[model samples]
Target: MTEKMLQQYKVWDAPTRIFHWVNFTTVILLLLVGTLMYFKKDLGITGLEAKIAIKEIHVWIGYVFAINLSIRLLWGFIGNQYARWSNILPGKSFPAVLSSYIASIKSGEPQQFLGHNPLGRLAVTLMMLILITLAITGLVRAGTDIYYPPLGASFAAHIAAEGVDPASIKPYDKTGTNPEAYQELKAFKGPFGDIHIYVAYTLLAIILLHIIAVVRAEITEGGGLVSAMFSGRKTLAKKPEDLN
Candidate 1:
């Protein structure tokens, strides 16, 4: 093979790699803490203590994820062409690109790209929305009763919908118990909390599928799919015709 033809490809920006791993670790940690809280198991403390600590950790991680997501969203607007949101959702071109990818996969031929493919882009977008909702709900739940008293009362009913009894906790007096506000908050909070949990589970499933797809591509396409995210290099085909 000619030297030029045998050369490998380089892709994936350093910032993107860092974001990927950081988000991965944060999600895993959140899952662990969430599981403990949902099950009400005494992970390492008494019943009440364990519940309190797990909830605290969950809230803190929610904040961390939210900040990281905001940074990523900003980066998407200003980053390289491959990283830009426009590249992923380029008007009507998105559907065509997505169809091409599906066709390539079915033909046992994977198309190489410098950045996320159409389906990948869509998945990332959905994941971001889900994470945002998760963070906002968690913040409202936390601030409602534990950290800030006045604000907590406003969202008391909403907080309770997430399986937390805002009234049971005596952190503040019932000085401004507006039943209407309480009921309104509760009505929204309850259904939103359930939706949040279900979406989290869906996110986990998507993550697993993403990992599997990467592994499959690496094996079949003879490309360093995983390492490319880390070291940003792909093995080149022996000849131009080999691209097929």
Candidate 2:
């Protein structure tokens, strides 16, 4: 048997690597805290103080997540060729490319891409959309539920009783708030809360699938798929399809 030759390619950039780990860390933290908050009662966690405290932690973590995501969004415009949206997101010719990639996979010759492969492009786009949804809904809930900033002051003012200081209003407490307006605010936030939670579950499912797909690609394709997120490089045995 002839010796196999492997090539090293600089793929992910520094900002991309940083964003990946930061996003991953913040996501895991948010999920852990969010899960606890969701099952607080069952977990024997009680009282308004505890609930607010947990939510505060979650919201803070969410702030980090949001900032990281925003930076990544901007980076997509100015980062390296592989990290740019032009390469990662599906363009006009995506369907044919996806079809070809799938056919290649079935024929036992999966195409290696320095950036994302066709299916990966789809997955990343879906994942980004989900993450953006989560960020918006989470912010809305942070404002409506615990009276956190960005939307909190406005929500508080909207629900405050006549002549009552919005600043004086407390979260989860109806005191100093107009009963009718408070009820309206609650109704308004209901759908956002629902979407936030359901989409969170969907994200979890997608993350699991993402992990599985990465592992499979690593094993069958001989690329350091997981390590690339950290080292910002990929090792491939064959020529990369998207390499320029």
Candidate 3:
């Protein structure tokens, strides 16, 4: 009987690993805080102060989420070969590549890659789009709903009463705000809130599927995927399909 020969590969870099863990932690916290806010009334939580406090916490977590996402996005442009957008994104040859990968999977000898496999690339692309949507919509809600920064002052100034300072406008308070303009601002922000929440629901499903896929790949492919994110290395028995 022949013994299996395994090879270790350097995969994830330090910045990539840091971004992954930070993004994961922030996403979990945002989900929990968002759930509390969504079901605050059902949980017997009441009063304006309590409601705003929860929202504040959620927004703070979202800030962390947004910053982490931004760093990762920027890193994709300048990071290592495995971390670059060229590796993560599907290109003109992606269809053929994906077909080949699927065929390999069916043959009982799944092809392995140091970076994302074709299917994994598709999943990551979809998730990145969803996350960017979440960040934009969340920021819009933060500004329109709570007078937070970036777009807050503009929205506040737009709705403020004549002779009133935009900075003096308190969230949820009608004073120092023109009624008609306030209503208009509310209408404008409504769709963003709707999209933010529904997309968040979709994200939950994707996250579940992502975890399942990772676990399945780890078991069937013997890549040490979970550990690789921490230790920045992958051990595989065969030569990786994406090895360069």
Candidate 4:
């Protein structure tokens, strides 16, 4: 009987690995803080002052989330082959790859990929988009009332929606501003907030599914994916055709 030969291939680069871990931790923080803010009353905050204190923590971390996402997106363009956008975004080869992967699924020998598989690529893309939307909406809400930076300057515009009274509610900025100017900017917080929430739930669902898929893949496919994020290498059986 022939023995299997394992080959270690360098996959995720250092930047990608760091981003994975930092984003993973940051996302957990954002979710926890966000949930707390959502149920501030139940959490026994007696006053808006106490409520805003917790919100401040969430907003600060959100800044970190925004920066992390921006860098990750930029890295996608210049990072290693495995971390590049070309791999994450299904291009012309995607159709063939999808069909091929789907077919291979039934064979009980999942198709091997040094980088993200097609479905994995799709999931990554969706998550990135969701993250961007969440960041924007979160900032807009801050602008709407909390008046955090990056979006604070635009708070007036985001403060009011169509046919809504801008003065009806107090501006979070609290600096000096023209009531007329604040009133003129179109505000669509209601719609944007809904998208932020619905997409957040969707992201949560995808993340859980991602975890399950990774564990299943590692067990059944013999890929060291879980450790790859930490060590940036994958050990696979060397094909004889590649042997000299």
lDDT of each: 0.67, 0.93, 0.93, 0.77
lDDT at position 190, candidate 2: 98
Give residue 160's lDDT in candidate 4 (0 to 100): 54
- Ranking of models by TM-score: 3, 2, 4, 1
Give RMSD to native, each candidate: 5.6, 0.9, 0.7, 4.7
List residue ranges in candidate 2 displaced over 4 A: none
Worst 10 residues of 2 by lDDT: 214-223
How far off is model 1, as Cα RMSD? 5.6
Query: Which pairs of residues clash in candidate 1, taking residues 3 or more apart in a chain or in different chains?
Result: 144-152, 157-186, 158-185, 158-186
TM-score of each: 0.77, 0.98, 0.98, 0.85
lDDT of 2 by residue, 129-232 (tens): 99999999999999998889789999999999999999999989999999999999999999999999999989999999999988888887768989998899
Per-residue lDDT tens digits of candidate 4, residues 42-112? 88876867777787898888888889888999999999878989778878978988888878777876777
Q: For model 1, state the Cα shift of residue 215 in Å.
A: 1.1
Highest TM-score model number: 3
Residue 41's lDDT within candidate 2 is 99
Q: Put down candidate 3 lDDT per residue, 1-244, tens digits, no spaces.
A: 9787999999999999999999899888988889898999999999998988888889988998999999999999999999999998999999999999899889989998899989899999999999999999999999998988778999999999999999999888999999999999989999999999999999999999999999988998888999999999999998998887
Per-residue lDDT value at 41 in model 3: 93
Q: Which residue pairs clash in candidate 4?
A: 142-147, 160-187, 161-187
Better of 1 and 4 by TM-score: 4
